[model samples]
Target: MIRIGTLNVGSMTGKSREVAEMMNTRRVDILCVQETRWRGNKAKEIGGGWKLLYSGADENSRSGVGIIVNSELKEKVVEVKRSCSRIMKVKLMLSEEVLNVISAYAPQAGCDEEEKSMFWRELDEVLTSISEEERVVLGGDLNGHIGTDRRVISRIHGGLGMGRGTKKAKAS
Candidate 1:
């Protein structure tokens, strides 16, 4: 099975190699990265046969999103869409199946409501554009909270999420 993951890299200026290394060690085939703060839309090779396709504002380094594909999957990319600085998507041909991977960065909680609304609207448009038969995977830092209670969303949440300030299990 193809392994996929996501991360909010904060800024991608000097972290491409490090991110690629981490993905290699983890055996991830595809990675969605957000908050790249990169300007312009372009694809760059980040060493070790990994490629990063990113989209960002032309004039500023603010919200941005990107997808990293390992050597095995890089050439399978069929289409790339940059919805905005905060959202981007890549379509890959995984054998006979089509996989649409999206990377997004949502506005923070304190941001104006209009901005947040626009982000959701754009995201919805992206989701609707994909064909029903195609597979979809979204990864990003959505900056949302479901509170400590999961009774309302247990069907989707699995009721295993930790509340704020909860200690994480140590990796042994």
Candidate 2:
């Protein structure tokens, strides 16, 4: 079976080797990464026979998203779409079925409403473009908290989260 996981690396500099080692040890076939804080849009081999497909705001450190696939499945990569610094998609041919994987990073709670709205709108657009029959896996750093009290928002959270809701959480 194919194993997939999501990680918020915060920043990728000086941590590529460590991340690669962990992926190898864990046998993670694919990994969706958020907040990479990396610059540019490109794909590269980051050692340990792993390939990383990444995108960021620009040529400077900032929000970013990426997908890392082990060497065994790298040949199965059919498409890589870097929509923006906060969103990306990768399509892999898994045997007879095609799997669509998306990596998205939401604006932090302190960001303006417009930024948050744009993030959702962009993400929604990406989601809509994919066909219904394809298998899709979406993962990322949401940058929000569900809060400890789930009764009021039972439909959204299951009450196992810690801390109280923040102003942004309440507003949304």
Top TM-score hit: 1
For model 2, residues 39-60, the per-residue Cα lDDT tens digits are 8899989998999999988766
The residue ranges of model 2 lying beyond 4 angstroms of the native Cα positions read: 59-61, 147-172
Q: Which TM-score value belongs to model 1?
A: 0.84
| Residue 147, candidate 1: alpha-carbon lDDT | 50
Model 1 over residues 10-97: C-alpha lDDT tens digits? 9999999999999999999999999999998999999999999999988765688999999989999999999999999999988889
Per-residue lDDT value at 148 in model 2: 72
Misplaced by over 4 Å in model 1 are 147-172
Q: What is the model-wide C-alpha lDDT for candidate 1?
A: 0.90
lDDT of 1 at 51: 96
- Give the deviation of candidate 1 from the true structure as CA RMSD: 7.7
